[model samples]
Target: MMSEKILEVKDLVVDLDLDLGDGRTRPVLSNVSLSVSDSEVLGIIGESGSGKTVLSRALVNWVSHPLRVSNGSILYRGQDLLTLPPARMQALRGRKIAYIGSDPGSALDPTLPIGRQIVEKLRSVEPGISTRDAAARVVQVLDAVRIPSARERFYEFPFQFSGGMMQRVMIVDALVTNPDLLVADNITQPLDVTVAAQILRLLQDLQRDFKTAILFVSSSLGVINEIAHNVLVLANGRVVENQSVGQLLSTPQHNYTKHLIADIPRIWKGGPDTAAPAPAAAAPEMEPILSVRDVDRFYATKDREKLFGKQIVQAVRGVSFDVYKGDNLGIVGESGCGKSTLSRLLSCLEAPDSGQILFKGQDIANMKAKELLTLRRGFQLLLQDPYNSIPPHLTIGRTIAEPLLIHGVPRREVHDRVTATMHEVGLSVELYDKLPVGLSAGQRQRVSIARALVLDPELLILDETLSALDQVEQSKLLALFDRLQAQRGITYIYISHDLGMVRRACNRVAVMYLGRVVELANNERTFFDPGHPYTRALLSAVPAIEDRPYKAETYLLEGEPPNPINIPPGCSFRTRCPFAFDRCATDDPRLRVRGLDDLAACHLQEINVPAE
Candidate 1:
C-alpha cells in the first residue's frame, strides 16, 4: 500500500539577493523537489553550502527576505502552503508543521523555565488547552525523551541543561504540539554519538507512535542511513538523485552522491581510506610532552534549593593520561564527560583542584603567572566554533600576528611569520588583509589554525575543532593537519565525540565516561577490541556507512550518563551497563592493565569475563 503524501515541494527555486548596486541574485537552491509521506522520513544529504538548509526552510515557506523563493509550490496535504495566507501559514507552522534547528542552546528562552516555555507554546497553538494540561503534556514528552527528573527539570531554565538535554527539550518543543510534519534541520549535528543514537531511536519511536512525517536534513550519510527511509541528494542547490536508503547506499547513480558516500570515514573496515596506524610508542627514554596525574577539577554552582549554599560539581575526577611527543591522542566520549574541562586544565585555562599536570617535565598547574604565560607559548588550544573563535573586526593577518605580537616578536618578523603560516594553512595571501566576514566555515577554521600555529606550539589541543564542518571540509582540514604535522612534528590532542574522525587521525584513543578515563589504548586495540563495556557501547552507537563490529542492539546504552553531581556509587557506568553485575554495584573499578599499553576500568577484566 502506498502511504499518503504529507508534504510535497515542486520545482522549488530559491535565490539570495546580492546587495550590489545591480540587482543580481545568486541561486541558493534551484529545481529542488521532494516529498515526505505519512510516518516516513525523507533524508536530505549534502556538503556545507549545498543549500540543504535553504531547502529545509523553503519546505515550510519559512524562507525569509534576502532568500526569496523565485518559483515553487509547497503542498501540505494538497493545500498549497506557498500561497496560503500569512495568518493561516503562521497558524499551521507550530500546530501542524514544526521545525527544530541544530543549535538548541539558542532555541529556547533563557529567562523562562523550559517547561513553562513549552507549555506556553502549547497554549498558543491550541488556545483552548488548559495550562495544567499543557504542562502535564510537556512533562510527559520530556520524560519520553529520557530527560531525567522531567517534573523537577520543568522549572529549570535552558541554561541548566546540557547540549544533549537541551536538544531533547527542543524535540519536546517541536513534538509537544503533535505537529504532523517535523522538519529537523541538522538537529543531531552537534550531539555526541550515544546521545545522537538515542535521538534517532526516539525519532523512530515518535514517527511510529505519532505518525509524524519527518524531513530530516544532515550532512552525514551514516546518520541518514540510521533513520532515513529514502535519501535525497542535493549539490549546489539541485536534486541529483532520490532513492531508498538501501538502494542509495548500494547503487548511488549520481557522481556527487558517490563522492559524498566515499567521504564518510570508516571505523572497523581496513582499506586505503582508513588512516594509517599511529607512530609506534615513543622511545622508552623519551618522556611524555604532557602528563596528567590524579587530576580533579570541581566547580561550585549555586544550590537551587538553598539560598547561601553552593554545590560542588566534580567536572573531572582522578583523570590521568600521558601524551608522548608527536602522538595524535584522541579523547572520545559523550557530552558532559569532562572532555572540555580536561582541555581547559591541559591548556592552563583552568587549574585542577588536585594532582599534577606536567608539560615538558615542568609542573604547569603550579607555575607562576609569568612562567605559565611563557610556557603557554609552547602549546595552543583550538575550540569547536570557528565563527566565534577569531575576532571578526580584525583582519586575517592581524589575527594570526596577534599571538606573535603578544610574545614581543619583531613587527617585521610578525608580518612574515603570519604570511608564511597563512600560506602554509592554504589561505590565499589575498585574504590576509580581509576581514573574516564572508569566509567559509573551513576558511575561518584555517585562520584559527594559522593563529594557533604562528606561535609554533609543540602541543595543540583541538576541542571538537572539526565537528562544525561538513564531511568534505572536515576531510580537507584533517589532511591539512596531517601535512602540518609531518612538517612541524606537532603533537595533537583531539578532544571529540567523532570516533570516525578520531580513527582517521589519531594513533592513541582514550574513552572517557563521567570525568574518568575508562579505557585507554592504541587506535587498533581501541577500535577492534575495546576493553571496557562503555567503550563497546560508544563504538556500537557510532553511525557508519561500513559495517561496525559492535551492534547497537547488544551494546547501545539506554540513557544519558548519570548527573556528575549525584554520581552513583561503585562503577559510575553500572546504571547503563547491560552486563553489569552485583559486584559492579558495590565495587568501584580502577584502571587496570588489560594488555601491553592497554588499560580499562571494568570489573569484568578481573574475572576474565567477555562481553555477551
Candidate 2:
C-alpha cells in the first residue's frame, strides 16, 4: 500500500425520482461505500440498473440531472467531495481525480482537433506553461498510449481517428495532468477484443508505471477479472460484495456474484450436441423465413484509378446461410467484421454483389416500393445506441406510434398498437408520454424495443443492441427477448461483441472475421469446441468471470487486419490466424461440417493452437 490513500468513498447514497406521472419518488441507489488506494485497481461490477455507474458519476459530482446525492460521503484524500464548494471541487477535479467515460467521442469536442483538446487541458492545469512546452508535453503523453505520429495526430479531430484511436486520445487527455485517481466507466466497450485487451494491458502497465489508482467499472465480469485488484459487486445501487479479484473469483460470497459468474456463456455439459435435439427432425416443418445463397458483396472505393485505390471491399464473400422460422442466429466478431452489412443484406437494405437473398422464398432485391415498405414491416433492426435510434424530443408514445403512422395505420389503431406494445415491453401507459431523455438507459432501450415491436415484425435484427446496457438491464432485456421469442415466435439475428451474451442469447452462432463467416455452429459447441482458429481465438479472448487456474498464452494479432479492400487471397483470417499454413494462404477454406451441429472454415483443428 502506498503512503497516501487515493480515494475513500463511504456511505454514499444517491437518489433519483422516477417522476411517476403524477408525483412519485423511487430510490435508485441506496447506501454504498468503497475505496481505492494508490496504485490499486478497484472494480465495480454488476448488471444494468445496479447503480455502479451512478455511484461513479456521483464521485465526480457529475451525476446526471434529476439524480443527486441524498446522503453519503465521498472522501478523497481527507476532503469530502459531496460537501466541497462548487468552485473548489471543480478545481480539484481532473487535477487530482479524472473520469474517462464510455464514449470518448461524446466526451471530446467535435469541432476542435485532438491536439487542441490536449493543449487546452494542459493549459488549464498549468496556466503559466508556454504553448511550445504544452505542445511538446502533449506529444509525449500521446506517445505513452502508443498512438503513432503523436505530434501530427494532435491536429486531427476526433472524427478523423477510428474508434480505438479516439479512446487512446481520451486516455492520454485524462492522464495529461497525472491525476492520482481515475474512474473509467465501461471505457473499452466500443473497442474490439484485441484493442480492448491492449487497452487493459496498457492500463495495468500504467498503474504500475505511474502508480495511479483506478475505479474500473463495467457490466462484464470477464473484463473485471483481467485488470482489477479488488472487486465490488453492486446491485440496485448497494454494495453486495467486495473483495480482492482472486477471492471474488474463487469464492464469491454473494449469490448474485455466483449467478453472474455461472451465467457466463460457456460450453454446456453436453457441449455442441446440446441444441435441444433439432426440433424432432421437423415433421410439420414451416418454410425457412430467410435464405441467403452464394452471397458476395463488394464496395468500390472512391479513387478507382490510383494504384491499389480501385480496390473493392468484399463484405460478404460467397456466404451461404439460412434462417429457419423462429430460430435465433447470432453473428459475433470484432467491430467492422461485416455483421451489420450482412444484417442489412438479409433485411434487403442492400443488394449482394452476386448472390440471392430470399425472404419467404421470394427475391427482395427488386421489390417494388410498396412491396419494399411491406417487407420492412416484417423485419426490424434494433440499433446499439438507443440515444441515436430513439428520438429524445418525442414522447415515448409518439415514437412508437410514428412507425405505425408511416405504415398508414389508422389513427385509432396506431394508438391501440402503441399502448399494447408499451405494456408488452414492461412500460406502463403513463410512461408513454415521457420523453426519452427523461428515462434511464434501460427504460430508453425498452422504449426503442417497443417502437420496433409496435410494427409486429417477425424477424428482429439486434445489432449489438444490448452492448450499452449494464448487466442487470441486459439480463432484463435478455429475459424479454426469450419471452418475445416464445410467445410470438419472433426470430432474431442477434449481433454482438460480447460472446458470453451471444452464447446465452442465441441457439446458433456464426463467427465473422474480416467480413467473412469463419464458422457456424450450435452455441454450446462454438463456445466449447470451436473448430475455426479465428473462432477459437475470439472465444479465448472473451474475459471470464471465474479465473481458471491456467491462463492460456495470448496470441495477439500481429498487425491491424489487412485492409478490407485488398484482403488476402485465401482465408480472410489467415493474416491474423496462428494456425494459418501454406495452403491457408492460397486456398480459401469453405465452411465445412466438422461435428454434429458445428461448422468451421479453417484448415486446422485444435483449441488454443499456437500462433507462429
Candidate 3:
C-alpha cells in the first residue's frame, strides 16, 4: 500500500556562486528528483563533498547566500515550496517541517532548560498555545523518545545530558510540533553504536506514531539500511541511484554505491578491509611495550546541590591491560565509558590516582620531568577533529615540522624530514606552504598523521581519530596506518566507539563499560565468542549490511550507562544487562580468565552461560 506523496522534488538544480571576477556559478546539485510519501523514511547516502547536506538544506528552502536553487520544484502537498512567499515559508518551516542536525550539544540554548527551549519553539509555531500546555506537550514527546525521567529532566540544561540523551532531546524538539516532515542531517554520526541503534528505533516509532516523513541523511550505509525504507544514493550532488533498501543492498545499480557498500567494515565476515591479524603465538611470548596495572583516576567536582561539598568522579576505575609490541589494540565503548580517560593515561597526558602505567618496564607516574619528556618522544596522540587539531595559521609543512623542531632537529634537515613524512602519509608536496583553509577532511587528517609521525614515534594513540572522516577517507587512513606499521613497526592504540572500525582495524579489542574494562580478548574471540554480556550488547547494536552475530532484540541495551559520578554497586553493567542475575547485583565481578587468552568481568563466567 503506497502512501500518498507528502513532498516531491523535480529536476532540482542548485548552484554555488563563485566570487571570481567572471561571475561564474557552479552547479552543486544537478537534475535531482525524489519523492517522499507519508510515514516514509527516505535516506540520502553519500560520502563527504557529495552535496548531501546541501540537498537536505535545499529541500527545506533554507539554502542561504552563495548557494541558490537555480532550477527546481519542491512541491509539498501540491504546493510549490520554492516559489512560496517568505512569510508563508517561515510559517511552514517549524509548523509543517522540522530539521535536526548532527551536533545536538550546540543545537539548543545552553543557558535555558531543555524543556523550556522546546516549549518556546512550540509557542512560536502556535502563538495561541499557553506556556503550560506547551511544556506538557514537550514532556510527553520527551517520554515518547524514551528519555528517562522526562519531567524532572525537563528542567536540566543541555550539558546535564550525555551525547545520546542530547540527541534524543533534539528529536523531541523537532517532534514537538508534530510536523509533516523531518530532515535529519547526520544526526547519528557522532553517537556510539548502542545509542545510534536506539535512535534508529526511536525514529521508526516516531514515524509510525506521528505519521511523519523523514529525510535521514548519513554517510554510513549501515545506518541507512537500519532506518531507511527507500535509499537514495547521491554522488557529487547528483542523484546516482534510488531504490528500495532491499534492492540497494542486495544489488546496487551504481558503481559509486557498490564502492560504498564495499568500503563498509564487516564484523563477523572476512573482507578486504579487515585488519591483518597479529601472530597469535608470538604475542604471548613477546614482552608488552605498554602495560596498565590496576590504574585508577578520579576527579573532584563541586556538588550541584551543595556548594561546600564535592563529588568524586571515578573516570577510570581499576583498569588494567597489556599492549604487546606491534599490536593494533582497540579500546571501544560508549561515551563517558572511560576510553578517553584511559587514552590520556596511556599517553601520559595525566597521572593516574593509583597503580602504575609501565611503558617498556618504566613506571610513567614515577618518571621525573626530564625523564617523562624523553619518554613522550616515543609516543604521540592524534585527536578526533582534524580541523581543530591542526593549527589553522600554520602551513601544512610547518605543522608537520613543528614536532621535529620541538625535538631540536636541525633547521636544515627539518624540511626534508617533514616533506618525506608528508609524502609517506599520502599528502602532496605541493601542499607544503598551503594553510589548512581549503583542505578537505581527509587531507587535514593526513596532515595530522604526518605531524604525529614526524618524530618517528614507536607508539601512536588515536582517540577517535578516524571517526570524523567519511568511510572512504577512513579506509584510506586505515590502509595508510597498515602500511606505516609494516614499514616502521609502529604500534597503535585506537580508542573509539565505532565497532565496525574496531572489527576491521584491531588485532585485540578491549570493551569498556562505565569506566571499567569488562572484557578483553583477541579479535576473533571478541567478535565471535564475546565473554561478557556488555560486549555482546555492543556487538548487537552495531549497524551493518550483513547479519549481526548478536541480534539486537536479545542484546541491545535500553538506556545509557548509569551516571559515572554515582556508579552503581556490584557489577557496573548489571543495571543494563538483560542476563543479569541476583548475584550480579549483590557482588561485583572481577576480570578473570574466561577462555583461552580471554578475560571477562561477569558472574556468568562462573556459570554455564548459554551462547548466542
Candidate 4:
C-alpha cells in the first residue's frame, strides 16, 4: 500500500426525491469524505438504504433515477469528476477508472456473446485500438479471472454462465481496460461464500499486480475485513467512523459500528446433536414429516456445435435426508450445490427423475395434479427475491389471499384468514391495501412470510429467504421464524450459503458439495467438529471477530470446482482437497457414521493429515 492518494471525496452529498403520494427530498448521502491511495483498498460498510450504493455511484458520476449529487467534490487524479466534460468523463470511465456492480446477471448483455461484450467495452474506451488487439486482450483477462475454457466460453451468452462465472466476467470486463482505480460496488453480494472469497482474493491479486486502488463497497463487515486495509463506516448517509481496519474492528469508537459488528450472525455450536433445546423438546421423539429417498434430478445443456445437445447435467445426484416435525434442517454449500433443486423436490414444485420424496408418507413423484395441489397447501416455499415473488401491482391483502382463494376456501373466510395471518406475521392491517412498492424491504419480506404462513403449512421451505436482508432485519425475521415454529409448530428447511445463519436457525445441517451431501450433522458437530474438509473450509471463510486480523492464506481452496456434467471419477472434492492421496483418486467414500451425532464422507478418518 502506498501513501499517494489515487482518489478523494470531499463533502459528498447526494439527494433523492420521492413521488409516492407525498413529494419529499431526502439526503441519500451527507458530508461523506474519504480517500483511497494507490494499491490500497478502502471498505465502505453500511446497511441497505444507508447511501453506500449512492455514494459509490456518485464517485463515478453515475447519479440516476430520482437521485442526484447535491453537493460534493469527487476528485480523481486531482480533477473533479463531478464537473468534468461528458466526453472526458466517458473516456475516463473504463480506461482510467472502472466500476463492477453487484448483479452480474443484469450487468452483462444477455443477447451478446461474452467475448463480443468485452471487445465492445474495450473498444468503447479505446477507439484507436485494433479489433485483433481487443480480442487478444479479452482472452488475457478471462484467463486472469480463471474462467475455464476461456476461449470457448467467450462466445457464449450471459445466460449460459452461472452466477460465479458471470461474476468473474464482471471482474474481467472491469480490469480488461487496465483502469488506474477500480470501484467494486457490491460485486460479491450475489455470490456464495466460496466464490465471494475467491473473488476477494482475485481483487487482492489484481491490486498487487496492477497497483490499482480499490474502493470496495458492501453491506458485509466481514467482506470488508477480508480485503480492505482501511475501513469507512456509514450510517443513514452520515460518516460514522473512518479508521484502519485494525482500529475500526478492535476499538470501534462509534456505537453504530459496534452494533453492526455485534449483529453479524456468530457461529454458536459445539455440543452434541442430541442436546435438544427447549423449543425443540419433542424433536427427538417426533417422526419425520418429510423424507427424501435417493432422489435424482438431471438437466440437459445446449451443445454449441452439435445438432442435438446430448450433455446431461446431473444437478441433484442420488441424495437422501429426513426432516423431522419440529426440526430446522439447514442445507448449506457454495453455488450449484443442488440446495435449490432439493428445495423444489421438497416443496412438490417439481418431480425428481428417479427415487422418491415422501411428504406425509406419500410419494411426491407419483402425486396426481389434485394431490400435488393439496401437498402444496401443506408445504409452503419462501424465496430469496421477495420483491419479484410478490406481484408488484397486487395489494398486500390480495397477494396473501391468492393462495387461499385458489384452495377453494370460502370467499367469506379468505379475508379473515389473510387478516389473521398478517397479524400473525407482525404486519399492520393498514398496509393491506398498499402495493408492494409502498412497503419497506423488511415489511415486504414480512408480507412474503405472511403469505406462506397464511396456508398454515406444516412444512416451510425457506430457500435463501433471509439472505437478501441486512443484519437487523434478518435477526428480526429469524426471531419471527422461531416464534412461528414455537407457536404454530411449522417445520423449517433453511437452504442458505450463510453458515452463521444455519448455525443460528438449524438443529441439524447437511453440507452438500457437487450435488452430494459430504457431511450431515447437527449444528454443533457441523461447526465445531466438522469431519469433512469442505465443511471446515466453509466455516473458516466466515470472518470471526474472535479470530481477527484476516489473512488470505487461511481457508484457501485451490483450483475451481469440476464441471457437474463431467464430475471427477473418484472423490469429487479431491481436486481441491489438501489431504487427497492415492485412495482419493480411485475410490469414492460414502457417508458413514463418524460419531454419535454426525456422518462424514471423507478419507480423513482413514488417514492422518500432517499440519503445516
* Candidate with the greatest lDDT versus the true structure: 1
Q: lDDT of candidate 2? A: 0.79
What TM-score would each prediction reach against the true structure?
A: 0.98, 0.86, 0.98, 0.94
Query: What range of 10 consecutive residues in model 3 has the weakest lDDT sum?
Result: 271-280
lDDT, residue 463, candidate 3: 97
Residue 199 shift from truth in candidate 3, angstroms: 0.4
Higher-scoring candidate on lDDT, 1 or 4 = 1
Cα lDDT tens digits, model 4, 1-612, are 337888999999888887575867788899999999999999999887788888888888999868888897999989999999999998899789999888889987888999999999899888999989999989988988888888888889998888888989998998998888999988877678878888888889889998899999988887898899999999999999999988998899999999898777666423344233523534556667898999999988886569886788888988988887888999999888889988887787788999999888889788899878877888899999867889998999999999998989999998889999999889999888888885767888899899888888999899999888777778789889889888998899999987667777888899999888999987777766778888877876764444522223655664467888899988999898866888899899888888776788887764544212
Residue 502's lDDT within candidate 2 is 78
Q: Which residue pairs collide, candidate 1?
A: none
How many residue pairs clash in each candidate at the backbone level?
0, 7, 0, 0
Ranking by lDDT: 1, 3, 4, 2
Model 4 / residue 332 / CA error / Å: 1.0
Encode model 2's per-residue lDDT on 1-612: one tens digit a residue.
Answer: 335677887777777767677646566778787778888999999886788778778888887657877777888988998888888888788587888988887888899998887888888878899888988988998888888778888888887686777878888888888889999999887777766877887898788888899999988887898989899998777889999988987889999989887655543434455333222221346577888888888898666357665657777777777888767788988766888888788777788888788888888876788888988888888888867888878888999898899989989788788998999999989987787775777888889899899888988988889888766578788889889887998988888887767767777888888777888887667766667767666655667654322223545543356668778887778877765678878988777777765777777743334232
Instruction: Please write out the lDDT profile of model 3 over residues 119-147, one tens digit for every residue.
Output: 99899989999999999999999999999
Residue 539 displacement in candidate 2 (angstroms) = 0.9
